[model samples]
Target chain A: MPSDSHEIVTQVYAAKKDNKAADSFIEAYMPFIRSETAKFTGRQPSQSDDELSIAMFAFYEAIRSYSRFKGAFLKYASVNIKRRLIDNSRRERRKLGVVSLDQPAGDNEGSSVLSEIIEDKGRPYDELEEREAVHQELAELTERLSVLGITLSDAAENSPHQKRTLEACRKAVDFARSEPGIIEDFLRTRRIPLSAIAQATGESRKTLERHRRYLAVVLLIFSGGFETIQEHIIQTLKGGAER
Target chain B: MRYIVAECHPAYAILLDENAELVYAANLHYSVGQTVESPVLMETEKTSGNRSAIMHTVRRAAATAAACLLIFGAYRLYMGSADRSAGSTIFMSANASVCMEINNKGEVISVKALNENGEALLSGYSYKGKDKATVSDELVELSISYGYISSGDTVSFYIDAPESGVYDSYRTELLGRLGSYPINTDIQKYDSSVQVRSDFTVSTQATSAQPETAANSTQSYSSMTETAETPAADTEAVTNSTVSTPADEQQAESAYPYHDPETYTGQSGEGNENWHGSGDHGYWYEESTDEEENESSTSEDTDQPYNRRHDWSDGYGRYGQDDDDEDICQYSEDDCDTSSESSWNSWFTGWSGYRFYSYCEREEVSECGGTDICTYDTGRDSYFSCEHGTECVQPDDTTDETEETEKTENMDETE
Candidate 1:
């Protein structure tokens, strides 16, 4: 199995420079690609399935661009396969005349589809609601950030660049979540409880101060009713922990 | 290089790149599933960028100022200590003695008077902003104006500095400045090992006399008196002479007439014996004789009574006139023809105890022909007016008569 993984990494590397190697590498990862598509489609992807074909194209694209910096070749190919399948689903939804969940539903002037619709078990609708919730949460976060003289762009720039520093920031967010007083103070003052976070998490005051804006945004997402935004951060942090 | 728009929001879009990484970029009105290159990603805010740039510039400026302060502080520390120990001290002596402390640049920092005459000489003088040479020249000019120095008198300089080069430079500069003056200039390096005598006693009577000539006459008389009295007693007399004479007088005596009798006596009590027995006596005697001659010649030209008294005393002591006290008194009466009555009386008053008695005996036996009886009476009264009390009269008693004869015999043998 190790040899197979090693062979896949070598093939992906060669494929980055040559198209024939990309095709060959994509063919080799067909099972992994179908499995990723199956996870999205909830079934085996037949050869005629356009999702299957899209997943294959995504795997080929992954091979054409893959480098050692991208981590395991199989995991990278799987992510590309899933992304392409999602893109295909959105493209089909567009064909079905659904512009965006954020847009008003059926000529309703001030109401979004997400506000008007009931909860549905349909995958597209569920995805639409999740995206709509994320968009709403992001809008709410943007407004709250502006009150603190911060912008989403400033939050992104002030975000810790190093993985360890990012983890430290996540730890600060978790500490703020556990300590209700910290969240209340942060909400009332619209400022990060920098010294409190540093003292509780054993992180340096300098590091916390450097990422104060980003920490404020993340703590707001955790402490407020911004569930969708908070989930995004949790997923990313989980991914980081897994790595 | 290519990203497919997976999800679009009001603020940003989640774009799926070929690397499978989801990136948040600014939404430029893009539809989902649209493949695009060069989408507007969320860039750093203009305010944050400007703030960072300003902060960077502030940090750099603070660092530069700190470096400049550190360099300046270190420079001040180094220069402060260097300035503390960098100066030279100049000791200038005529009859007036002044000490000038100078900096490395030769500028006088302070002037201190070493005697009362020096204080009078420097009363109206200011050394501010003047260099060593300028200050020395001004001081010399002041001494001349105060009559502390004359055409034939010597103005001696002693320089104490951190380096010999400083001494030499100061000497050269002072010589160049005072070379045109009529007075003689004597410059020498000062040895700190030799203890400087600050308490210099000058007689008001001889203030106008040449300091070197008067000092030589006094030192010769003091040494002769010391030798005539006791060899061990010479130390106290030499110390008294050293303390009473001006600094230049002591220096001249040390350089020519006498080697520091204190140092010689400190080595052993036989200092007087070594002083006379050593070949140094002839050179010293010759130098003293030459000084007396020069003093006599200048006295005739200048009409100084102090110089004539010095000549009389110097000749009396050196020619061993104590052997025939009667003939010496006759000679003093004959010399009174050339000097004023008061000067002659004052000269007689300055005589030693033995000579005072011999002069009294001469006045009793001989008629005061060339000299008046009042002159004799004045000398007798002045001699007895000293605070010595009965000690002044003890020399005439029988107990001290043997001691006086012994001193007279010692004086004859030394001559």
Candidate 2:
């Protein structure tokens, strides 16, 4: 039992970094994923089933995100698979009509029905382009964070849990944005000027130091022309303040 | 909360929300850059490790403090109540009876009246902040002022303590205070080791013994007065006449001598036995005979004239006059011996005014000098002169001595 658990943890850690390892890990947990989908749907799901595909995707996501802190990998994967299947079912219910998008164009031979899609004001294409732009912005932010010896996971982990501490971090970010030199200094030194931020914003040095990596990520996103990421953080801060 | 698929993976996709923050979501046949609304997102643990640890420590500390406060509060309540209910108990009985609950520090915790008279005696009295001795002194004074106890009446104290030494100390302190009053007091001790009887009735024996002592002393004084008035009277016949006389006037005279302090020690010592004996007339008579001997010894030590006055005036002269008034006549007898001792002290203490007042009053002399000096002192060049002749003449010395000696012999015979 211990060896099996050790193997599962080892596979999940490997799968987080390697796409092939993640694919193989999903294939190995296919039976477990099917069982979780079966529990949610209350019936056996075939290979072609959409719920089965969603559960498989959820299992793969669990592998990518699994850490020792989250406890037994199988239990975590089972919960993720069940939740994903429920979400998919709910989303499917909200659709007004289901279109295949692969339907044949009646007038043109060898043309799919997707070619006739003009009504919806090109929303899907625009959404797709917007998604690509967001992806570019995120990739840029990820690259900048890596330069500061921080991962996206580390930033998520070190983010302040308490509202007061989060407000203090935001204040320090605001101060850095106001004084461009501080942001330049951070980028040059690759270090958060905790004492200067503490003095300028009246936030304690300890708070800035404790959340130094998260502050660095926010500051870099703001200074490095990552407008998509910056707007996302501003919206989140506004929503938190409203709450 | 819509998300656009930013990057697609075989297992999960990095999706960007409208806010542009990247999130991990399950990929369901999604191509790269495909916009997806309401995607199934990964659930990350909300609380950080450090925050959870701080919360756990804070919870444990709060629980510990609550437990400690509960225990301490319960203990304080228990001890406070324990102090109130624990300690020595004292039952004081004059004509009125009261039971005092005292703490270890000798403070009076409560004073409960045992009967109607006791309730009346303690009415409007506050015992708060007063120690046992002070409370006792005040209670005895109240007993007198309220007429629950007066000249020669007995006040009895029953003390029950956690130890014999405690009982002894209470007995001594109480007796000492009560001795100052012109009344008799008796003390009985009980060790706390013995289970105290729940029934708080003053013992029948103790109650009966006090009156018996008072009656014996009253009877002796009557006999002595009879001997002084009629020198030819038979001693046994005179002793038997005790039951016929009104003893209030003589009892009042007996109370006066208590102004002398020397007699207080002897009276207190005698108070111990007054409650010890069974209420047997024979026992009391024997005790009175002992008192007579002590008196005779005192008379021998003092001057002849003073002895004659003491022997005549301090006897049960008023006992015969107040026969119907048993309260005054009965208890008057207890002070006869003390009166003999007081006569000696009163002379040096210049209590001559009190002596003359008692003398003139008892004799019913209408024109006895200024109501302060008896007409008997007119023959001597003393503190006061009288216009009236010395109506109180000395009885023939030989005859008076013969009568006293005979009375002593008869009392001894009776014993």
Candidate 3:
């Protein structure tokens, strides 16, 4: 009996000359292509998906270029396929932005653009009912923030104005996200856990204390039950205000 | 870790600009159930002001988008349509040298010789759709033509290598020719081994022959052919024989060293049933059967264990007797020294190989007239009566010995 390498060599040589053989080689590895694409995309890729097509083309390209010196065929093919899918996704992201701020807030009849929702300053009176609802939500948020001795005025005063300071404050919020114990402790004790935040973030304790109120508001939104304001705060922190 | 907890008012904005001014507008401290008007300026502020601000922002954004679209549309109109030649496809042979550009209706647009010498050879020939000719040089031959496949407007270039040029040159030339067109091109290169004068006449014939000839020339073709011809039958037979041979051979070898000559001959005869390398074991079985028949005819030979064992040995010899004896002996010294020796071997053997050993042993004992004795050999207890077919104890003799002991005890007590 011929070894596995021998069999593959024959199939590859046949594939180079015959269209049917080349197609059969592709058809045989279709499941493998789908699995690799799914691994990269984090979801099962379907036949109609552009990612699947890119993976299949990468597999074909691998077959054309493969030699015995390249080692195992599937290993080489898998690496090539994954790299191609990643490159394709990056290119697609550049050409067609994956996350669009233009999407409507919801299926509700009066739902406005996400950009408007994130920038809450100029809400139209037609959305006054929604604004009234947000007013009550803000009252609740104020009650929550007061647990950390942070008032609305404190947050306004503590809000970072310079881009560098905003970035540093954003990093602190990100640190708080990864370490939820700090948020829980702050809520339970009614004070910012500055040392814990510093330890987790490797930031100076003073820096965390200075941005305590701003971080408190960010953390409260992240703590859940405040979707609209959370989206706005997150976008603003990501420099969406300048955009 | 802080022990001190303080109560503080959370009724205020944290991130908004001038949030302290906005907090007085919150009006959360209003007296419950009060009929008085609240002093919240932001809430009571007219909605017209907010609406105007929103309208101004929306209008500005719309104007910006319109301006971007206008610029993009203008750029597309000015510079985009220059490179697009509608429905024109290019076809080149295996080498990039010989090229033919065809229009939408399968009409030849231009034929170019990319190589140095072939420029003059293919130039002035107006092969425009009527370009059906075999241009041959000292090295190779070119058959170029315009034709139709199911996918419309195919330019088939059959490269015929008559004397001496590499297939790569022709193929590279064909690829280069197709690469120049800004349209979807299908360039099919016929096998270089076959020499055809024109693509129009022999396109179908050469295309069909390519796969077969390519299959024949492959280095692994013989192995592939073997795999293809009797795929099902050969796979099954090969796999079964390959799997079973090593196991059976090991058993035969393991039995060979320790068994008595007569028992070894019997065991090997049955163990090697699947082993066809030797002379027919069928003939061996027949000769042994004749001897057994003659021996059994002599009814006076009841003492011979082989005579009593032959009936049960037929089944046991094939599967178990030879193999299980070693296991039973191994278990006897270590485990059978305990009180439950016999049952432990039975349990161990039952769980291991010989799932049917228990049933076979019971049947064999019964078929030996139910008087077949269980002899305790110090080497290995008689797990099977005819494993050696030599030593066995009758069940009636053991019963007699127990009765004698009972009688002796009664006599002593009476005295």
Which candidate wins on DockQ?
Answer: 2
Q: Any runs in candidate 3 off by more than 4 Å, and if so which? A: A1-126, A238-243, B1-415
Q: State each candidate's clash count.
A: 0, 15, 18
Tell me how far the alpha carbon of residue B390 in candidate 3 is from the true structure, in angstroms, after superposition: 99
DockQ, in order, for the candidates? 0.01, 0.11, 0.02
The 10 consecutive residues of candidate 1 chain A with the worst lDDT sum are A234-243
TM-score, chain B, model 2, is 0.34
Q: Which TM-score value belongs to model 1? A: 0.29
DockQ-derived CAPRI band for the predicted complex in model 3: incorrect
Task: Estimate TM-scores for all models.
Answer: 0.29, 0.39, 0.20
lDDT per model vs. reference: 0.52, 0.55, 0.41
Name the docking class for model 2. incorrect
Interface RMSD of 1: 39.0
lDDT of 1 by residue, B245-294 (tens): 23444565555443332354432122433122221111011122444333
